[model samples]
Target: MGGLIFWKLRGSDEKPVASVQPPPPATTPQVFEQPPPPPPPPPPPEEDAGKKPAGKVVGVGGGGCAGECKGTAGATLQSALAAKAGAARGCYERGLRQNATLQGKLVISVRVGPGGQVCSAGVASNALGDPGVASCVVGLFRSASFPAPEGGCVDTQVPMNFVPKGGGK
Candidate 1:
């Protein structure tokens, strides 16, 4: 049986050779010109930093001044805060996951340096009763940029009223 199987497998006694022969060298040197690459794609559209947040974020006026601490314009602070409304809403929304009905007033105290940098920021007062939301909102303010305060450092309080979508304020 072994001899019969070997005979059947070795039926083709001729050895098979596989080889690829390279093309003969060209008589004249060839010069090929490659086409120029396509122009770089246009930059993506920038997000609207001023876009209003989905949640209700009513602006309140309370830019009181203290000794040596100048008070910035409410409109200026409001514009800066409006730019960050979406992020603030994000913080509120994150807390909403924990408490679906999390909504209240938040007074964020921010100190802006003469160079328009946030020197310090914190939750001056939070009625939301959610520490996570308060911390998140404060964090957003910490990295927020604003117009340079005239004269010296300016301390401002931004009062924001938060109400969930479709909910009464």
Candidate 2:
């Protein structure tokens, strides 16, 4: 037949398909509001205006020198070196004797024991190449002594500049 016609059976074994539905309309998203932040804590109260602030007094020495004993470590080392300046000069003189043209700077570290005696000494920096000169300088420092520190030992580094006699500037 030119135009075909199809017939449907009502009581067939095949099941009917479900119909499709259109999607729901779009809507604005809901937002949950957050609570405000807590306030900052109050500052501590100021001290009494009439009363002076309490402070611990650190005494380097007894009586009159208590307050004037600033930088005791340095002062002690300096005084100790001053007491041994002559011997240190001698060591430098010896170095000069070895090499008439020897001129440079030497830095040495000295450790003062608890009993105020130099426990050890070593050259920290040396521009002078002579081992004899270095050893002489170290020996001079090792024989020096300093005032005993409050409770323990003290260490200090001293820098010495060497220049030949009659050398200018």
- Residues 114-166 of candidate 1: C-alpha lDDT, one tens digit per residue: 55667678988989899988988899998788876666568878787888889
lDDT of 1: 0.73
Please report, in order, the local distance difference test score of every candidate based on alpha carbons: 0.73, 0.63
Residue 92 displacement in candidate 2 (angstroms): 2.1
Q: Could you give candidate 2's per-residue lDDT for residues 24-50 as a string of tens digits?
A: 987979888888888886654455422
Give TM-scores for every candidate, taking all chains together and pairing residue i with residue i.
0.56, 0.51
Global CA lDDT computed for model 2 = 0.63
Q: List the residue pairs that clash in candidate 2.
A: none
